[model samples]
Target: MKRVPLYAAALGFIVFAGFPFYWMFITAFKQNRDLYVGAFDTRHVPWIFNDPPTLEHVRLLFGQTDFLRWVANTLLVIVAVVIITVALAVPAGYSLARLVGRWGGRLGMGIFFTYLIPPTLLFIPFSRVIALLGLQNSLGALILVYPTITVPFCTWLVMGFVRSVPWDIEEQAMIDGYSRLAVIIRIAPRLILPGILTVVVFTFTLVMQEFVYALTFISSVDRMTVSLGVPIALVRGDVYHWGSLMAAALFTSIPLAILYNLFIDRFIQGFTMGAVKG
Candidate 1:
Protein backbone atom coordinates (compact mmCIF):
# COMPACT_ATOMS: atom_id res chain seq x y z
CA MET A 1 0.00 0.00 0.00
CA LYS A 2 2.86 2.34 0.82
CA ARG A 3 4.48 1.51 -2.52
CA VAL A 4 1.36 2.76 -4.32
CA PRO A 5 1.84 6.36 -3.16
CA LEU A 6 5.58 6.18 -3.77
CA TYR A 7 4.95 5.04 -7.34
CA ALA A 8 2.31 7.72 -7.80
CA ALA A 9 4.73 10.40 -6.55
CA ALA A 10 7.48 9.11 -8.83
CA LEU A 11 5.14 9.13 -11.83
CA GLY A 12 4.03 12.68 -11.05
CA PHE A 13 7.60 13.91 -10.78
CA ILE A 14 8.54 12.23 -14.04
CA VAL A 15 5.59 13.85 -15.81
CA PHE A 16 6.50 17.24 -14.37
CA ALA A 17 10.07 16.95 -15.50
CA GLY A 18 9.41 15.41 -18.93
CA PHE A 19 6.41 17.49 -20.00
CA PRO A 20 8.48 20.46 -21.18
CA PHE A 21 10.63 18.34 -23.48
CA TYR A 22 7.53 16.58 -24.75
CA TRP A 23 5.92 19.93 -25.38
CA MET A 24 8.96 21.12 -27.23
CA PHE A 25 8.95 18.02 -29.41
CA ILE A 26 5.26 18.44 -30.08
CA THR A 27 5.64 22.13 -30.81
CA ALA A 28 8.53 21.45 -33.14
CA PHE A 29 6.25 19.31 -35.28
CA LYS A 30 3.26 21.61 -34.83
CA GLN A 31 1.99 24.00 -37.51
CA ASN A 32 2.43 27.67 -36.57
CA ARG A 33 -1.34 28.03 -36.31
CA ASP A 34 -1.55 25.26 -33.73
CA LEU A 35 1.11 26.80 -31.51
CA TYR A 36 -0.34 30.34 -31.83
CA VAL A 37 -3.70 28.94 -30.76
CA GLY A 38 -2.04 27.68 -27.55
CA ALA A 39 -2.03 24.03 -26.47
CA PHE A 40 -3.66 24.81 -23.13
CA ASP A 41 -6.99 25.51 -24.79
CA THR A 42 -9.04 22.29 -24.51
CA ARG A 43 -10.75 23.21 -27.77
CA HIS A 44 -7.46 23.02 -29.64
CA VAL A 45 -5.99 19.99 -27.81
CA PRO A 46 -7.79 17.61 -30.16
CA TRP A 47 -6.71 19.67 -33.18
CA ILE A 48 -3.18 18.29 -32.65
CA PHE A 49 -4.47 14.97 -34.03
CA ASN A 50 -6.64 16.50 -36.77
CA ASP A 51 -3.83 18.61 -38.18
CA PRO A 52 -1.12 16.62 -39.85
CA PRO A 53 2.26 17.11 -38.20
CA THR A 54 4.81 18.89 -40.39
CA LEU A 55 8.59 19.16 -40.61
CA GLU A 56 8.27 22.61 -42.18
CA HIS A 57 9.72 24.38 -39.13
CA VAL A 58 12.77 22.14 -39.08
CA ARG A 59 13.16 22.60 -42.82
CA LEU A 60 12.80 26.37 -42.51
CA LEU A 61 15.26 26.55 -39.62
CA PHE A 62 18.03 24.90 -41.63
CA GLY A 63 17.21 26.43 -45.00
CA GLN A 64 16.35 30.01 -44.09
CA THR A 65 18.69 30.64 -41.15
CA ASP A 66 22.40 30.00 -40.67
CA PHE A 67 21.48 27.41 -38.06
CA LEU A 68 23.96 24.80 -39.24
CA ARG A 69 26.68 27.44 -39.16
CA TRP A 70 25.67 28.50 -35.68
CA VAL A 71 25.71 24.87 -34.55
CA ALA A 72 29.16 24.36 -36.05
CA ASN A 73 30.46 27.52 -34.41
CA THR A 74 29.05 26.52 -31.02
CA LEU A 75 30.48 23.01 -31.38
CA LEU A 76 33.88 24.40 -32.26
CA VAL A 77 33.96 26.64 -29.21
CA ILE A 78 32.68 23.84 -26.95
CA VAL A 79 35.31 21.40 -28.26
CA ALA A 80 38.12 23.89 -27.71
CA VAL A 81 36.90 24.78 -24.21
CA VAL A 82 36.56 21.10 -23.28
CA ILE A 83 40.10 20.36 -24.49
CA ILE A 84 41.57 23.34 -22.65
CA THR A 85 39.59 22.65 -19.47
CA VAL A 86 40.52 18.95 -19.38
CA ALA A 87 44.19 19.56 -20.14
CA LEU A 88 44.50 22.27 -17.51
CA ALA A 89 42.06 20.96 -14.90
CA VAL A 90 43.35 17.37 -14.80
CA PRO A 91 46.91 18.36 -13.90
CA ALA A 92 45.84 21.17 -11.62
CA GLY A 93 43.39 18.85 -9.87
CA TYR A 94 46.04 16.13 -9.44
CA SER A 95 48.61 18.56 -8.11
CA LEU A 96 46.15 20.01 -5.64
CA ALA A 97 45.14 16.53 -4.52
CA ARG A 98 48.58 14.84 -4.38
CA LEU A 99 51.13 17.60 -3.81
CA VAL A 100 52.00 18.92 -0.36
CA GLY A 101 52.98 22.58 -0.42
CA ARG A 102 52.23 25.79 1.36
CA TRP A 103 48.65 26.83 0.50
CA GLY A 104 48.22 24.08 -2.12
CA GLY A 105 44.69 23.10 -1.02
CA ARG A 106 43.80 26.67 -0.17
CA LEU A 107 45.05 27.81 -3.55
CA GLY A 108 42.87 25.21 -5.29
CA MET A 109 39.87 26.39 -3.29
CA GLY A 110 40.69 30.00 -4.10
CA ILE A 111 40.96 29.30 -7.80
CA PHE A 112 37.62 27.51 -7.78
CA PHE A 113 36.05 30.43 -5.92
CA THR A 114 36.98 32.69 -8.85
CA TYR A 115 34.45 30.76 -10.96
CA LEU A 116 31.70 31.85 -8.59
CA ILE A 117 32.25 35.44 -9.73
CA PRO A 118 29.24 36.14 -11.93
CA PRO A 119 29.80 36.83 -15.61
CA THR A 120 27.57 39.90 -15.37
CA LEU A 121 30.20 41.53 -13.19
CA LEU A 122 33.01 40.71 -15.62
CA PHE A 123 31.34 41.43 -19.01
CA ILE A 124 32.16 45.16 -19.13
CA PRO A 125 35.85 44.56 -18.38
CA PHE A 126 35.87 41.62 -20.78
CA SER A 127 34.38 43.81 -23.53
CA ARG A 128 37.29 46.25 -23.14
CA VAL A 129 39.74 43.35 -23.43
CA ILE A 130 37.89 41.97 -26.45
CA ALA A 131 38.01 45.34 -28.23
CA LEU A 132 41.71 45.67 -27.49
CA LEU A 133 42.48 42.19 -28.85
CA GLY A 134 40.18 42.67 -31.90
CA LEU A 135 38.26 39.49 -30.98
CA GLN A 136 34.92 41.24 -30.88
CA ASN A 137 32.24 39.14 -32.66
CA SER A 138 34.71 36.26 -33.00
CA LEU A 139 34.19 32.64 -31.84
CA GLY A 140 37.71 32.73 -30.42
CA ALA A 141 36.53 35.26 -27.87
CA LEU A 142 33.77 32.90 -26.67
CA ILE A 143 36.20 29.98 -26.54
CA LEU A 144 38.66 32.00 -24.46
CA VAL A 145 36.04 33.45 -22.11
CA TYR A 146 34.17 30.15 -21.57
CA PRO A 147 37.12 28.40 -19.93
CA THR A 148 37.21 31.06 -17.24
CA ILE A 149 34.23 29.38 -15.54
CA THR A 150 34.49 25.79 -16.85
CA VAL A 151 38.11 25.29 -15.78
CA PRO A 152 37.79 26.44 -12.20
CA PHE A 153 34.73 24.33 -11.33
CA CYS A 154 35.98 21.38 -13.34
CA THR A 155 39.36 21.61 -11.61
CA TRP A 156 37.66 21.60 -8.21
CA LEU A 157 35.45 18.66 -9.20
CA VAL A 158 38.43 16.69 -10.52
CA MET A 159 40.44 17.57 -7.43
CA GLY A 160 37.94 15.77 -5.23
CA PHE A 161 37.94 12.73 -7.57
CA VAL A 162 41.74 12.65 -7.67
CA ARG A 163 41.94 12.89 -3.90
CA SER A 164 39.61 9.89 -3.57
CA VAL A 165 42.08 7.77 -5.59
CA PRO A 166 44.70 5.77 -3.68
CA TRP A 167 48.23 7.17 -3.94
CA ASP A 168 49.87 3.93 -2.72
CA ILE A 169 49.69 2.53 -6.25
CA GLU A 170 51.44 5.60 -7.67
CA GLU A 171 54.03 5.41 -4.87
CA GLN A 172 54.73 1.75 -5.78
CA ALA A 173 55.16 2.75 -9.42
CA MET A 174 57.58 5.48 -8.34
CA ILE A 175 59.57 2.96 -6.27
CA ASP A 176 59.78 0.79 -9.43
CA GLY A 177 61.67 3.69 -11.16
CA TYR A 178 58.68 5.42 -12.84
CA SER A 179 58.65 9.18 -12.49
CA ARG A 180 55.59 10.82 -10.84
CA LEU A 181 54.35 12.18 -14.17
CA ALA A 182 54.81 8.77 -15.79
CA VAL A 183 52.87 7.09 -12.99
CA ILE A 184 50.02 9.53 -13.45
CA ILE A 185 49.95 8.98 -17.20
CA ARG A 186 50.14 5.18 -16.84
CA ILE A 187 47.90 4.64 -13.81
CA ALA A 188 45.86 7.68 -12.79
CA PRO A 189 44.06 8.00 -16.13
CA ARG A 190 42.48 4.59 -15.79
CA LEU A 191 41.20 5.23 -12.25
CA ILE A 192 39.94 8.71 -13.07
CA LEU A 193 38.37 7.94 -16.47
CA PRO A 194 34.89 8.50 -15.08
CA GLY A 195 35.86 11.87 -13.62
CA ILE A 196 37.35 12.92 -16.95
CA LEU A 197 34.16 11.96 -18.78
CA THR A 198 32.12 13.87 -16.22
CA VAL A 199 34.18 16.99 -16.79
CA VAL A 200 33.82 16.69 -20.58
CA VAL A 201 30.04 16.40 -20.41
CA PHE A 202 29.70 19.14 -17.80
CA THR A 203 31.87 21.53 -19.78
CA PHE A 204 30.02 20.78 -23.02
CA THR A 205 26.60 21.28 -21.44
CA LEU A 206 27.61 24.53 -19.72
CA VAL A 207 29.08 25.97 -22.92
CA MET A 208 26.04 24.98 -24.94
CA GLN A 209 23.62 26.64 -22.49
CA GLU A 210 25.57 29.85 -21.97
CA PHE A 211 23.67 32.82 -23.40
CA VAL A 212 24.78 36.13 -21.87
CA TYR A 213 28.41 35.94 -22.88
CA ALA A 214 27.57 34.72 -26.35
CA LEU A 215 25.04 37.52 -26.81
CA THR A 216 27.36 40.24 -25.55
CA PHE A 217 30.47 39.09 -27.45
CA ILE A 218 28.99 38.09 -30.79
CA SER A 219 27.01 40.21 -33.27
CA SER A 220 27.76 38.81 -36.73
CA VAL A 221 25.02 36.54 -38.00
CA ASP A 222 27.38 33.77 -39.09
CA ARG A 223 29.56 34.04 -36.00
CA MET A 224 26.74 33.70 -33.48
CA THR A 225 26.62 30.58 -31.32
CA VAL A 226 23.52 28.37 -30.97
CA SER A 227 22.33 30.13 -27.81
CA LEU A 228 22.47 33.52 -29.48
CA GLY A 229 21.37 32.45 -32.94
CA VAL A 230 18.11 30.87 -31.88
CA PRO A 231 16.63 33.98 -30.33
CA ILE A 232 17.91 36.36 -32.96
CA ALA A 233 16.81 34.34 -35.96
CA LEU A 234 13.51 33.03 -34.62
CA VAL A 235 12.17 36.01 -32.75
CA ARG A 236 11.46 39.26 -34.55
CA GLY A 237 10.80 42.50 -32.69
CA ASP A 238 7.72 41.76 -30.52
CA VAL A 239 7.03 38.62 -32.54
CA TYR A 240 8.03 35.03 -31.75
CA HIS A 241 8.39 32.27 -34.30
CA TRP A 242 7.20 29.57 -31.95
CA GLY A 243 7.40 26.64 -34.34
CA SER A 244 10.89 27.33 -35.65
CA LEU A 245 12.14 28.28 -32.18
CA MET A 246 10.89 24.99 -30.77
CA ALA A 247 12.46 23.08 -33.63
CA ALA A 248 15.82 24.75 -33.07
CA ALA A 249 15.63 24.16 -29.33
CA LEU A 250 14.74 20.50 -29.85
CA PHE A 251 17.56 20.05 -32.32
CA THR A 252 20.09 21.61 -29.94
CA SER A 253 18.91 19.47 -27.02
CA ILE A 254 19.10 16.12 -28.85
CA PRO A 255 22.91 15.88 -29.02
CA LEU A 256 23.36 16.72 -25.36
CA ALA A 257 20.62 14.23 -24.40
CA ILE A 258 22.34 11.46 -26.33
CA LEU A 259 25.71 12.33 -24.82
CA TYR A 260 24.25 12.24 -21.31
CA ASN A 261 22.67 8.84 -21.88
CA LEU A 262 25.85 7.41 -23.39
CA PHE A 263 28.05 8.44 -20.45
CA ILE A 264 25.39 8.36 -17.74
CA ASP A 265 26.88 5.39 -15.90
CA ARG A 266 30.36 6.87 -15.81
CA PHE A 267 28.93 10.31 -14.99
CA ILE A 268 27.09 8.89 -11.99
CA GLN A 269 30.22 7.01 -10.90
CA GLY A 270 32.26 10.21 -11.15
CA PHE A 271 29.86 12.06 -8.85
CA THR A 272 29.77 9.09 -6.50
CA MET A 273 33.55 8.97 -6.34
CA GLY A 274 33.67 12.69 -5.65
CA ALA A 275 31.02 12.44 -2.94
CA VAL A 276 32.29 9.39 -1.04
CA LYS A 277 35.74 9.29 0.56
CA GLY A 278 37.77 6.16 -0.01
Candidate 2:
Protein backbone atom coordinates (compact mmCIF):
# COMPACT_ATOMS: atom_id res chain seq x y z
CA MET A 1 0.00 0.00 0.00
CA LYS A 2 2.80 2.42 0.90
CA ARG A 3 4.71 1.41 -2.24
CA VAL A 4 1.66 2.28 -4.32
CA PRO A 5 1.90 5.97 -3.46
CA LEU A 6 5.65 5.91 -3.99
CA TYR A 7 5.24 4.35 -7.40
CA ALA A 8 2.57 6.85 -8.34
CA ALA A 9 4.76 9.73 -7.27
CA ALA A 10 7.69 8.32 -9.22
CA LEU A 11 5.55 7.90 -12.31
CA GLY A 12 4.29 11.48 -12.01
CA PHE A 13 7.82 12.79 -11.61
CA ILE A 14 9.01 10.84 -14.63
CA VAL A 15 6.21 12.17 -16.79
CA PHE A 16 6.87 15.73 -15.64
CA ALA A 17 10.61 15.52 -16.20
CA GLY A 18 10.55 13.45 -19.38
CA PHE A 19 7.73 15.18 -21.24
CA PRO A 20 9.72 18.10 -22.60
CA PHE A 21 12.51 15.87 -23.83
CA TYR A 22 10.01 13.46 -25.38
CA TRP A 23 8.33 16.39 -27.11
CA MET A 24 11.65 17.65 -28.40
CA PHE A 25 12.70 14.24 -29.71
CA ILE A 26 9.42 13.65 -31.51
CA THR A 27 9.33 17.22 -32.82
CA ALA A 28 12.75 16.79 -34.39
CA PHE A 29 11.48 13.85 -36.48
CA LYS A 30 8.28 15.66 -37.47
CA GLN A 31 7.90 16.76 -41.08
CA ASN A 32 7.92 20.50 -41.70
CA ARG A 33 4.40 20.37 -43.12
CA ASP A 34 3.01 18.77 -39.95
CA LEU A 35 4.92 21.19 -37.79
CA TYR A 36 3.78 24.33 -39.60
CA VAL A 37 0.26 23.07 -40.12
CA GLY A 38 -0.15 22.62 -36.35
CA ALA A 39 1.43 26.00 -35.77
CA PHE A 40 -0.87 27.72 -38.23
CA ASP A 41 -4.07 25.74 -37.58
CA THR A 42 -5.84 26.23 -34.28
CA ARG A 43 -8.20 23.28 -34.87
CA HIS A 44 -5.50 20.84 -36.00
CA VAL A 45 -5.77 18.34 -33.18
CA PRO A 46 -2.38 18.24 -31.49
CA TRP A 47 -1.17 14.70 -31.97
CA ILE A 48 2.59 14.18 -31.81
CA PHE A 49 2.82 10.45 -32.60
CA ASN A 50 -0.10 10.67 -34.98
CA ASP A 51 1.98 12.59 -37.52
CA PRO A 52 4.27 10.69 -39.88
CA PRO A 53 7.93 11.04 -38.81
CA THR A 54 10.67 12.05 -41.24
CA LEU A 55 14.48 12.20 -41.34
CA GLU A 56 14.52 15.12 -43.76
CA HIS A 57 15.20 17.51 -40.88
CA VAL A 58 18.20 15.55 -39.72
CA ARG A 59 19.56 15.24 -43.25
CA LEU A 60 18.98 18.94 -43.97
CA LEU A 61 20.64 19.98 -40.68
CA PHE A 62 23.80 17.97 -41.16
CA GLY A 63 24.01 18.73 -44.87
CA GLN A 64 23.50 22.51 -44.56
CA THR A 65 25.09 23.54 -41.23
CA ASP A 66 28.52 23.94 -39.64
CA PHE A 67 27.16 21.81 -36.82
CA LEU A 68 30.20 19.55 -36.50
CA ARG A 69 32.46 22.58 -36.12
CA TRP A 70 30.14 23.98 -33.43
CA VAL A 71 30.20 20.66 -31.62
CA ALA A 72 33.99 20.56 -31.90
CA ASN A 73 34.35 24.13 -30.62
CA THR A 74 31.96 23.39 -27.74
CA LEU A 75 33.94 20.29 -26.80
CA LEU A 76 37.21 22.23 -26.97
CA VAL A 77 35.91 25.00 -24.74
CA ILE A 78 34.42 22.51 -22.26
CA VAL A 79 37.63 20.44 -22.06
CA ALA A 80 39.73 23.56 -21.48
CA VAL A 81 37.31 24.84 -18.83
CA VAL A 82 37.30 21.46 -17.08
CA ILE A 83 41.10 21.37 -17.02
CA ILE A 84 41.40 24.93 -15.71
CA THR A 85 38.55 24.50 -13.20
CA VAL A 86 39.80 21.21 -11.75
CA ALA A 87 43.44 22.29 -11.61
CA LEU A 88 42.67 25.59 -9.95
CA ALA A 89 39.68 24.54 -7.84
CA VAL A 90 41.02 21.30 -6.32
CA PRO A 91 44.25 22.72 -4.91
CA ALA A 92 42.76 26.08 -3.99
CA GLY A 93 39.87 24.34 -2.28
CA TYR A 94 42.15 22.03 -0.33
CA SER A 95 44.25 24.97 0.82
CA LEU A 96 41.19 26.98 1.81
CA ALA A 97 39.75 24.10 3.79
CA ARG A 98 42.97 23.05 5.55
CA LEU A 99 45.20 26.13 5.73
CA VAL A 100 42.70 28.83 6.65
CA GLY A 101 41.51 28.46 10.22
CA ARG A 102 38.26 30.37 10.89
CA TRP A 103 37.87 32.24 7.59
CA GLY A 104 37.62 29.31 5.17
CA GLY A 105 33.85 28.94 5.24
CA ARG A 106 33.24 32.66 4.83
CA LEU A 107 35.77 32.86 2.01
CA GLY A 108 34.07 29.97 0.22
CA MET A 109 30.73 31.74 0.35
CA GLY A 110 32.26 34.96 -0.93
CA ILE A 111 33.80 33.14 -3.88
CA PHE A 112 30.43 31.56 -4.71
CA PHE A 113 28.78 34.97 -4.52
CA THR A 114 31.04 36.24 -7.28
CA TYR A 115 29.47 33.72 -9.67
CA LEU A 116 26.09 35.44 -9.20
CA ILE A 117 27.17 38.65 -10.88
CA PRO A 118 25.30 38.41 -14.15
CA PRO A 119 27.39 37.62 -17.24
CA THR A 120 25.40 40.37 -18.91
CA LEU A 121 27.40 42.97 -16.97
CA LEU A 122 30.72 41.25 -17.64
CA PHE A 123 30.43 40.76 -21.42
CA ILE A 124 31.08 44.39 -22.38
CA PRO A 125 34.33 44.52 -20.43
CA PHE A 126 35.19 41.00 -21.55
CA SER A 127 34.68 41.99 -25.18
CA ARG A 128 37.12 44.84 -24.72
CA VAL A 129 39.63 42.50 -23.09
CA ILE A 130 39.20 39.97 -25.91
CA ALA A 131 39.84 42.69 -28.52
CA LEU A 132 42.85 44.12 -26.69
CA LEU A 133 44.39 40.66 -26.58
CA GLY A 134 43.61 40.25 -30.31
CA LEU A 135 41.72 37.00 -29.58
CA GLN A 136 38.32 38.28 -30.68
CA ASN A 137 36.16 35.62 -32.37
CA SER A 138 38.64 32.94 -31.32
CA LEU A 139 37.90 29.91 -29.12
CA GLY A 140 40.86 31.02 -27.00
CA ALA A 141 38.92 34.12 -26.00
CA LEU A 142 36.06 31.98 -24.61
CA ILE A 143 38.56 29.64 -22.96
CA LEU A 144 40.02 32.64 -21.18
CA VAL A 145 36.72 34.24 -20.14
CA TYR A 146 34.64 31.17 -19.16
CA PRO A 147 37.02 30.33 -16.32
CA THR A 148 36.22 33.58 -14.59
CA ILE A 149 32.65 32.40 -14.12
CA THR A 150 33.35 28.67 -13.71
CA VAL A 151 36.35 28.78 -11.36
CA PRO A 152 34.94 30.75 -8.46
CA PHE A 153 31.82 28.62 -8.10
CA CYS A 154 33.72 25.38 -8.65
CA THR A 155 36.32 26.47 -6.10
CA TRP A 156 33.57 27.07 -3.57
CA LEU A 157 32.04 23.66 -4.32
CA VAL A 158 35.41 21.96 -3.97
CA MET A 159 36.07 23.80 -0.72
CA GLY A 160 32.91 22.37 0.78
CA PHE A 161 33.82 18.89 -0.45
CA VAL A 162 37.39 19.07 0.84
CA ARG A 163 36.14 20.33 4.20
CA SER A 164 33.97 17.23 4.51
CA VAL A 165 36.95 14.86 4.14
CA PRO A 166 38.26 13.57 7.50
CA TRP A 167 41.48 15.36 8.38
CA ASP A 168 42.87 12.23 10.09
CA ILE A 169 43.47 10.64 6.68
CA GLU A 170 45.71 13.45 5.59
CA GLU A 171 47.38 13.69 8.99
CA GLN A 172 48.27 10.00 9.02
CA ALA A 173 49.52 10.22 5.45
CA MET A 174 51.67 13.18 6.43
CA ILE A 175 53.15 11.33 9.44
CA ASP A 176 53.92 8.48 7.06
CA GLY A 177 55.90 11.09 5.06
CA TYR A 178 53.48 11.66 2.20
CA SER A 179 54.07 15.19 0.89
CA ARG A 180 51.17 17.58 0.15
CA LEU A 181 51.70 17.03 -3.55
CA ALA A 182 51.80 13.28 -2.99
CA VAL A 183 48.61 13.38 -0.94
CA ILE A 184 46.96 15.40 -3.70
CA ILE A 185 48.01 12.96 -6.40
CA ARG A 186 47.57 9.72 -4.49
CA ILE A 187 45.13 10.09 -1.58
CA ALA A 188 43.10 13.18 -2.39
CA PRO A 189 41.87 11.79 -5.67
CA ARG A 190 40.27 8.81 -3.97
CA LEU A 191 38.79 10.96 -1.22
CA ILE A 192 37.33 13.62 -3.48
CA LEU A 193 36.38 11.55 -6.52
CA PRO A 194 32.68 12.37 -6.29
CA GLY A 195 33.39 16.06 -5.90
CA ILE A 196 35.67 16.03 -8.93
CA LEU A 197 33.10 14.25 -11.09
CA THR A 198 30.49 16.76 -9.97
CA VAL A 199 32.71 19.61 -11.13
CA VAL A 200 33.28 17.92 -14.50
CA VAL A 201 29.58 17.31 -15.19
CA PHE A 202 28.57 20.73 -13.86
CA THR A 203 31.08 22.71 -15.90
CA PHE A 204 30.57 20.64 -19.04
CA THR A 205 26.83 21.38 -19.02
CA LEU A 206 27.43 25.06 -18.23
CA VAL A 207 29.67 25.69 -21.24
CA MET A 208 27.19 23.89 -23.48
CA GLN A 209 24.32 26.13 -22.35
CA GLU A 210 25.91 29.52 -21.63
CA PHE A 211 25.06 31.99 -24.40
CA VAL A 212 25.33 35.70 -23.60
CA TYR A 213 29.13 35.79 -23.56
CA ALA A 214 29.34 33.41 -26.52
CA LEU A 215 26.87 35.39 -28.61
CA THR A 216 28.55 38.73 -27.92
CA PHE A 217 32.09 37.43 -28.30
CA ILE A 218 31.77 35.07 -31.28
CA SER A 219 30.25 36.32 -34.53
CA SER A 220 31.95 33.98 -36.97
CA VAL A 221 29.95 30.90 -37.99
CA ASP A 222 32.93 28.58 -37.69
CA ARG A 223 33.67 29.74 -34.15
CA MET A 224 30.25 29.56 -32.48
CA THR A 225 29.43 27.09 -29.70
CA VAL A 226 26.51 24.67 -30.06
CA SER A 227 24.08 26.95 -28.27
CA LEU A 228 24.70 29.90 -30.57
CA GLY A 229 25.89 27.97 -33.60
CA VAL A 230 22.76 25.88 -34.16
CA PRO A 231 20.30 28.73 -34.04
CA ILE A 232 22.40 31.30 -35.88
CA ALA A 233 23.70 29.01 -38.57
CA LEU A 234 20.63 26.83 -39.16
CA VAL A 235 18.11 29.60 -39.47
CA ARG A 236 17.97 32.48 -41.92
CA GLY A 237 16.92 35.84 -40.43
CA ASP A 238 13.31 35.75 -39.14
CA VAL A 239 12.79 32.22 -40.51
CA TYR A 240 13.24 29.64 -37.77
CA HIS A 241 14.48 26.16 -38.64
CA TRP A 242 12.42 24.25 -36.12
CA GLY A 243 13.28 20.73 -37.28
CA SER A 244 17.04 21.23 -37.37
CA LEU A 245 16.92 23.31 -34.22
CA MET A 246 15.22 20.56 -32.27
CA ALA A 247 17.49 17.96 -33.84
CA ALA A 248 20.58 19.84 -32.67
CA ALA A 249 19.13 20.22 -29.21
CA LEU A 250 18.33 16.50 -29.05
CA PHE A 251 21.78 15.34 -30.11
CA THR A 252 23.58 17.80 -27.84
CA SER A 253 21.60 16.82 -24.73
CA ILE A 254 21.71 13.01 -25.12
CA PRO A 255 25.40 12.54 -24.33
CA LEU A 256 25.24 14.65 -21.18
CA ALA A 257 22.12 12.86 -20.06
CA ILE A 258 23.76 9.47 -20.53
CA LEU A 259 26.91 10.53 -18.68
CA TYR A 260 24.95 12.01 -15.79
CA ASN A 261 22.79 8.92 -15.51
CA LEU A 262 25.88 6.76 -15.31
CA PHE A 263 27.12 8.61 -12.22
CA ILE A 264 23.85 9.79 -10.72
CA ASP A 265 24.46 8.23 -7.35
CA ARG A 266 27.89 9.82 -7.03
CA PHE A 267 26.57 13.13 -8.35
CA ILE A 268 23.83 13.10 -5.73
CA GLN A 269 26.34 12.18 -3.04
CA GLY A 270 28.54 15.12 -4.03
CA PHE A 271 25.64 17.56 -3.77
CA THR A 272 24.30 16.24 -0.47
CA MET A 273 27.72 16.06 1.11
CA GLY A 274 28.67 19.55 -0.04
CA ALA A 275 25.40 20.97 1.21
CA VAL A 276 25.29 19.23 4.59
CA LYS A 277 28.95 19.67 5.47
CA GLY A 278 29.28 23.20 4.19
User: Could you tell me which residue pairs clash in candidate 1?
Assistant: none
Candidate 1 lDDT by residue in tens digits, 210-266: 988898899888898898999875676788777788889888888988987886665
Q: What lDDT score goes with residue 105 in model 1?
A: 72
Which candidate leads the pack in TM-score? Answer: 1
Alpha carbon lDDT of each predicted model:
0.83, 0.83
Worst 10 residues of 2 by lDDT: 269-278
Cα RMSDs, all models: 2.9, 3.0
lDDT of 2 at 235: 80
Model 2 agreement with the true structure over 131-179: per-residue lDDT tens digits: 9999998889889888888888777777777877898897899899999
Deviation in Å, model 1, residue 255 alpha carbon: 2.9
Q: What TM-score, to 2 decimals, does candidate 1 have? A: 0.87
